[model samples]
Target chain A: MTITGKNKNKAVVESVAQIIFTVCASFAILAVASITLYMILSGTPAIFKVGLKEILFGTVWKPTAAEPKFGILYVILTSVVGTMLAILIGVPVGILTAVFLAEVADKRIARIVKPAVELLAGIPSVIYGLLGIYLLNPLMYKLELKIFAGSTTHQFTGGANLLSAVLVLAIMILPTVINISETSIRAVPPSIKAASLALGASHIQTIFRSILPAAKSGIVTAIVLGVGRAIGEAMAITLVSGSSVNAPLPFNSVRFLTTAIVSEMGYSQGTHRQMLFTIGLVLFVFIMLINIALTKILKKGAAEDGE
Target chain B: MGNDTLYQKRKRPGEAFLMAAIYGAASIAVLLLLGIIGYVFFKGFRVLNPAFLTTVTSSLKGTVGIAGNLLNTLYIIAITLLIATPIGVGGAIYLNEYAKPGKLVNLIEFTTETLSGIPSVIFGLFGMVFFGNVLGLGYSLLNGSLTLTLMVLPLIVRNTQEALRTVPDSYRSGALGMGATKWYMIRTILLPSAKPGILTGVILAVGRIVGESAALLFTAGSARILPKLGTNLVENLSRIGGKILQPGGTLTIELYLQMQNGEYEVAFGIGCVLLVIVLLINLLLKVITGNARKYGKQ
Candidate 1:
């Protein structure tokens, strides 16, 4: 009876603690639930009121005008084109740099280069924006003047354009691509290299033929992740892209989907504000697709390795 | 012999080109870092002064400073981590110890993954609408901290889970075998062993909290004012309750403002401050993880 009494207090405390933890553990689900609920609840009203085709396909996005056009076609196009350009440029450099780190560089050189990459990764997006404005814009402006000498357009952003945004994004995605691809490359078992060597394949030949193919899933994951980062990025692109809703010509100023919301979120009101949330929902859907792609690739890779 | 000659002829130039390209890529990565750091340090170092660090920006006083934003950054870090750490650590313990491989576990894991993958801008919008307006917190540090808690919970949970996994099963069994309850065992053995990992997660969360701008911009409301700091600790403590409800912008937000206004000199100065902080964080991370912390989306 005394032993039971002694244990009763501890048991109660244990049960309480367990309950607390279970609640805590459920926070992630609660957060996701709330976000999804809030996103859908807030994002759909504007679409229904404004018509989906008009908002998604409309070329003009003047949400505050008397006859306001809620078209995000140009904004969507800029994000898509800019993201593609960034991936096209960033992926090769990132993969090659990973190859250099994993298989090619001297241990000493790799050691030095590796920390630089970490520091690059650690740098804030805002700093990238500042640098874009500081260094990149001026140079691009000079080029713009040179290329379009005697051009009629009076508006010059001094380099704040789609080109600058793409370059900044390309650089930003580098560390993500490099780190994942490098880790994956390093994870490629050395036996694969040995097998290739035994088959009369030279070192570079083996890397391209055997090792890269082996790590293809990871490289693809890196690219998808890079694409996600580029699409979702705001502050850096906002500062550089000049925050205009326009066709995504290389030198033309533009607003990506992320920057579109940010550049307008401050003062946007009523339907204008609702439209921004709608823009966010579109972005969320894009991210969901990317995340699904990521999971699919990761799952497939795991299954293959299981085999 | 002919096959060998053909293979050799085809391989050399292509091989040489690829190798050169690899080397070039490596050089570009290095140069990009060097160029950014070099530019920031060169221009920003010249602009830094004790006054700029110490004072608040005032048009009337004809002064420029980041003292307010710096304090806000510190406040956000402290408040966000305080709100997040206990819940995060508790969640990790539950997931790693109590939960079995079941449907609930899978749901929790999926939600955690999905939460991590969501964009900060979306979080900002949600925080703005839900926390700032709907909940009537109305753009305050308290509001930002709450938003950031959700933003960073996945990180802490992830790192702490990894740490908890590293603690041996023997430790748990041994503690339970000694007549200790599960909670007691977790507290006494599992936690102490996972301290470094938990601390790493907390610190990384701090890094993310500090680096964040978009998420805080709307929720926190970029109103630049320093919190009260008098000699009386009691008075200060008492007033903090009232003060947290006031709006503030962190260092990154201020930096963005400066850049937007084309205030390069001040922007670079803020950049230098941020760079130093990030380097210090990475240095600490290197020590704790005892390895170069691999780059991943935060």
Candidate 2:
């Protein structure tokens, strides 16, 4: 074939290939677009009807009363408190565990523990729910009784409460925190550790002072990831969170944003159901905010690594 | 490697406490894992009789089995994988191989990362609204599978992109030098070399699908019966096609429903099976990656 004819054929093939690739790539775009649109379109009406301020900041959530109140303040508080507590407990434990695997543990132990963490991550949230229901709730119930035995002022709980949700959320988030923290800790340049040790700082001091600081960005990224997971988690929390829309006291049966939607979604209707979608919308926005933070932190971490 | 001596003098009080705390944290994690696995198995094993595996759950018969869920789980996995693999792999190829390093690639990557970070419950919400109601698939296995296809698409693309990147540029150049078309070269050389990653990605997606509950709940509905397989061979073949369009519950969904109904034994049994399956998948992943590394070294 002539060179001109061959070039034309090549151009045709290339364009065809490009079009196919573009179509495939569009799947991601389409997924994001459709999800956002659906959530907003379906989730907005209820918020408008309920009055945005009342739905968002109101303390009452009697969606089925003769005169229903749609305040989601308590649910929002429960989710925030639950996520914060999870982060508080989960971050320290996860960072310590990551340090153990990356710095303190011998290779064989690290090898074993690392896979266990991965396995923990792989366990379904539903199984976590199962465990939470069977194990954690009962334990929490006993603890609650013991703690509040003399206090008639405190509410009685059967153990499924915010505290139980926090505990489960903490455990659920460990995999993300540990994996990222360990990677970042290990990524801290060996030279930095050596120099710190050479300056007469003890091994522990060098790790604490030098390595942790150097891995700060990555560790921050890890925490952000943990926060994201904790806030977004639903199934496990739904099972253990005692699912009542109440103030987020440790012993109180509180509803989270995720659980609030799920517990009511099955049987809810009319404005109540629309409100659930609005709650979903709220959750989606929370997730998007977390995602933005994560992307920024990760980009910063990557840039530092490059440097 | 010689840094061991730096740790020899770590006898300070604070150092000892910190070291203890670190080890304690690691032990807690490992012990928690052991406790979870042990508890599930102990609770479940006694209930998992041979009859339990084979019988359909019947209130009249007073028997509980997950045969329907098992079959449904297999069907969902097969259908989800079938639909997702080609599109996801193609998207990955586009990103890593065909697309130039520019705005389009960046946009796709950003969107995929966003897609992944969106919680499964939101996907469940979206699936119920979009696939179930709008698409008129209405709470069927096919609807659930399509929703999952979107969820797992990012996983396959990211995995396949990583795999395709590991395929050295030399192969591409050599194929081009031999007058091979880009498609021919990718099919014959790049894909075969990247098979392990693709397979690993698919297996991981299977793991996600099997463990999934929240997303499947609304889209797949909560039917615990087997989708009607036909009486005859022709009917059976047609049944397979029809079943995908019908509502059914997989293992995870059944686990949730069982718990809701207070069937602790059945739920635990399902949890045990899920845990075992997850463990097997993790082991398979390790084995594949280990082999890949060994081969790369060679």
Candidate 3:
């Protein structure tokens, strides 16, 4: 065949290959979209039957008993409170660590700390739960805490409680906050720091006043991402949250949304399954709302930076 | 003047104390990671034996090995990588090379980001409904692999696309100028150049697949026995050919199940093993990519 004819044939083949690849890529996206649609559509009928008030506001969660109530307020509250607790404990420590890596520490120290944080990120949640059970629970007991205080008569044992869940979550999310905060702090202009130092401000003062403020948005994004992760975490929470559906009252044990879905899905029949899907949908909406809020904050921050 | 100097020096001491406290907090965070790993290793070492790696649970004694679980994890990894890697790379190539900036590409991007954000439990639900119920594959390795394929497809695509994007345009122009077709140029030039990125994606995907428990919970039913070798190979090949469905267990699921049953030592040991595998792969990829960059610069 002529060279021109061969080139034309190759172009046709290339076009065909491109079309095939696009179809496959598009199909993957469609599959995920369809999953979301299927859950929403299938779950809506149950939501309507139960009424949104009972599903969202009711306190009880007895799906297996003769009388079944599918309220998720308690679960949602547990997830929120647990995540907040994690953030409270993790954020300060993470910020300090970020500062240490970014400003206080030398490159060698930063290198060691950075990979250690990444390694922490890679540790499976199940292992975290196990560590909490073996170590944190015992430590809590040693401190005369009520971690194992009410366990004798309870369905579950020691080591599985809200505090334990929150502690583990704090550990799990530390890497995220530290990494992002460090990056943001590093991005602060060197001139700003030099100027602050030239004006007789100490390194610590300059970091807090200039660098921290400059990197505020990134730090906030890191915290938000950590919250998203903590709220959505399942296995760790399941293994630690005592798997109790009772309303979480301070030190009392509780269950989160993800835990409720995993623990109950095995035996959840009829409305129960739908309710679980509804819980997932609720979680999805919450994350999406947070993500949208985060995006808005980031855009505003960008605008301010531009100005 | 002496008194004022003394006051200033006292304030500096307090500042140094505060800095020490701040540094201490940061060090504690790093120490927490080391403490966790150390705790796991110390506890797990008691159970790290050949039998732990070789035997399958045969009786109610619960002292059995995780041989079957190990096999199942390997099988799932092989099947998932075989299915996901090529398609992920192909989709990425299309996105980087052929597709223009348009609605479809934007949709693809959105879908990938959303998929990455959705909780694993949701993926579990999707896998349960789609693979377990709709496809009628039942609870099998095929279903689990497919679920994971869906879960990691976006990640692999994004990574591969980024990798492909980083390849200089000059290479493409050079190839085209030599009268090479786009297909030939992509296959021989771009893909090879982006191999390290593709491998890094594969490594990350492997880490995820190895660690995934929630999605596999519904798709790959809690089977505790290893398939016979012949059957295993057949099933493996069929999965590669996109044909078979067999229920299997992964390392994460095994660890989860074991921990739930209070097999603490076993779970920790397996966790250590899994962590080692992941770290090894990550280090290997780092080394490979480091070398690739060095050579590329030359």
Q: Which of the numbered candidates is closest to the native, going by highest TM-score?
A: 2
TM-score, per-candidate, Cα-based: 0.95, 0.96, 0.91
- Ranking the candidates on TM-score from highest down gives 2, 1, 3
Please state the Cα-based DockQ of model 3 relative to the true two-chain complex: 0.56
lDDT of 2: 0.89
For candidate 1, what is the TM-score? 0.95
Query: Which residue runs of candidate 3 sit more than 4 Å off their true CA positions?
Result: A141-159, A297-307, B1-14, B60-63, B229-244
lDDT tens digits by residue: candidate 1, A1-307: 6999979988999999999999999999998888888989899999999999999888998888999999999999999999999999999999999999999988998989998998898888999999998889999999999888887974676789999999999999999999999999999999999999999898899999999999999999899999988999998878789866888899998889999888898889999999999999999899888888888898899998899
Compose the digit string of candidate 1's lDDT tens values, residues B1-298.
5687644645488899999999999899999999998899888998799998888999999999998888888888999999899999999999998898999998898888877788889899889878987899989988999999998999999999999998879888888888999988988898988888899999889888888888888789787776667999888887766768889999999999998998999999999999999989988988877632432112
Candidate number achieving the greatest DockQ relative to the actual structure: 1
**lDDT tens readout by residue for model 3, A129-179:** 777777776665454344445556544435467877888898888988989
Predicted candidate 3 versus true structure: per-residue lDDT over B36-98, tens digit per residue: 888877877777789888878777766667887887887788888999888888888878998
DockQ head-to-head 1 vs 3, winner = 1
Q: Candidate 2 clashing pairs?
A: none
